[model samples]
Target: MRKRGKYIIDKRMKFKRGYQRKMILKIKNDNNLTWKNLADEFDVSIQTVMNDWGREFATIPYSLGIRMIDKYLSKEKNLILSYWISEILPKKWGQFLAGELNKKKIKIPQESEGLAELIAVILGDGHLERKTLTMTGNFFEREHHKYIETLVNELFGLSAYNIKLKGSNALQTKFHSTELIDFLIKNGLVLGNKITNKARIPEWIFSKREFMLAALRGLFDTDGGIYNKQKGYKRALIEFQTHSPFIRDNTIKLLQRTGFTPSKSASNNSSIGCTLACNTRIQNQKEIHKFFNVVGSANPKNILRYKYFLKRGEIPLKDKIYKEICRIKIIRPFKRL
Candidate 1:
C-alpha cells in the first residue's frame, strides 16, 4: 500500500466492481471482446474475470489493474505510471483525456559564452530543481538578476520570470525549462540536490578566454563585493566569497591569469568558506581596474563603486614614461626625480 497524504492507497486490493467497470469501458473502447480473451491478454485468471462481472470479488491487486490499463492504452511497458483515470469521463471530455498523453518536444540550446556565464551565476547563487533553474539575490542587486534574464532569452530563446518576495529584500528569478536542466547536466552541471552534489566549472571553458571571462564575471557579480571604508584611515578593497573550494580556487587562478595578485583567507569560525581579497591600495587599483577591463561587474552596487573609484582617481592608468623614468633613476643613483 502506498500512502498518499492523509489517504492510504491499498495497492494489494482495490474495489473489484469499480476497477472492472473502468477496465470494461477501456476494453470496449479498444474493441477487445470476451472476458476469457481479455483475461488471457492481461494474464489474469478467468475466475477473476467472472468475479468482476458478478461483482463477487471485494478488491483487485494494484499490479494487475495497472497492467490491464497499460495494455489497453498501449502505453510503454517501462513507464511506471503513478496515476490512472479510474473515474469515468463524459463522452465530450474523452478527447481532452486522450490529448493529455501527448509528449512535448523541447529544443535544447547549443552551448555558448552567454550560456556559460549563466551557468556560472547559477553555480554561485542559484539552485536547480527537477523542472527549473532559480537564481536569487537581494532586491538591491537587481542588475545581476536582469543580466541573467537577458542571458536566458538570448541563449535558450526563453522568457524567464522575476518575482519580489513579500516582506523580504531577496528577489527570485526562475526559468521553467526541463530541457534547460538537461542541457546544464550535459554541459557538466550537477542536477538535483546541489549542496551534497555540487558541480564544478566545465574544464572546456578554460580554453576559451571570452567564455572564461564572461563566466568569471557572472560568478564575481553574484558572489563578490567591493569595499570602501570612509573612516579614520580610509581603505578600498574587493573580495569574492564562496563556500565551494572549487569555485574559490578557480576564481583565484582566473585572477592570476589576468595579472592580479589576491590573498586568500578562511572565514570566521562560524562560517564554512573562504574569501579572496585584494586589500592594499596598489593591489586593489591594479586588480579592480583589470577586472573592470576584462571581467567587469553586473551588480549595480559594485558597478557604482567601480565608477566612483575611477572618478576619484583611485584607480589610475599606468603611465609607461613615468614608470620607465623611475626605472632608469633606480638603475643610477646620479639620476633624480
Candidate 2:
C-alpha cells in the first residue's frame, strides 16, 4: 500500500497537500515575494490566482476578496493555489500546467507575462511552430485573448532584422529565449540577472548561454542607450574600456576590423563614442538627444543604442564627441591618462 501524509501524490484526489508543501517551499525561498513569487513558484500566472474563484472554495466576503487575497493571503496565495490546483483541480489539470512550465521560452511562467512573451516571440518569428505547447488548446482555454498577433506587432515590432537577430542555426534552436532554454536544457535557465563581486547585469535575463553571449556581443555592436548606473548597474553588463590598462596595446587590436588598424586617432574616436557628457548635459533636454548626430540613425535602431549605453549615462555631443575622435580615432599611446 502506498503511504500517505497530509499531502497525497497520485492520479486521484490530486496530491494537494504535497503540492502545497512543494509550492510553499518555493515561496519561502523567493526573495522578492512579488507576484513573480507565485509565477516562478507554481509556474502559473499571478492573474490566475487573483481570478481564482474564492466563493467556490476559500469562502470570504465579496468586498474582502481582493484585500484578503492581495494583502492577507498574498504570501499564502502561492501555497493556497498550489493546493487548490494540485488537490482541488483535476489531477490532469495539474499535470497540464506543470507541463506548460516545461515548454521552452515560457517567459516568466506566469499566465500573462509568459504568454505575452511567448506570443511576442511566436508572431515575431522568435519561436518555432510546435505541437508540444500550443496557443490553441491548453493556453487559449485559459487566456481569453482575441488573437496572439496584436500583442506581437504592438510590442516587439517584429521585422526581418528582429527575426534574424533572434533566429538560430542550431539544429533545434528556436528564436525566442524561452523555448531555446527549455529545449536545450532539462531544468536549466539563463538567470535573468546575476550579481557578483565584480559586476551585475540588468534584469534577470534567463535564456540560453549561447544567447546570453550573443546578447553581450550584440550590445557591443548596437546601441540601446542602456546605462549600467541607470539600472544601478544591477540590470546591465557593465564594461568601462577606458579603465583597462590595455586601452590600446591589447584591446584596440582586438576591436579592429579586417584590414583596419588601431591608431591614436581611432582610439580617440572610440573614446568619444563611449562618452556620456554628464558635465554638459543641459537640464530638461531628454538624454536621447545625444544620438542625433550618429551617421546612420536607422541602422541599429534607438533601442539597441539604449540597451548598449543604458543606465550608463548621457552621451557627449559636439566638442566632446570631437575630442574622443582625436583619442581613439586610431593613433595613440594616449601620451597621457
Which candidate leads in lDDT?
1
lDDT of each: 0.57, 0.27
Q: In lDDT terms, how accurate is model 2?
A: 0.27
- Model 2 TM-score? 0.24
For residues 222-251, could you state the per-residue lDDT of candidate 1 as single tens digits? 777665534433355677777666566677
- Looking at model 2, which ten-residue stretch has the lowest summed lDDT? 189-198
TM, every model: 0.57, 0.24
Local lDDT at 328 for model 2 = 24
Alpha-carbon runs more than 4 Å astray in model 2: 1-87, 90-179, 184-217, 220-337
* Candidate 1 lDDT for residue 316: 26
Q: Which stretches of candidate 1 lie over 4 Å from their true place?
A: 1-107, 192-195, 229-235, 268-282, 312-337
Instruction: Name the candidate that leads on TM-score.
Output: 1
- Give residue 314's error in model 2 in angstroms: 9.2
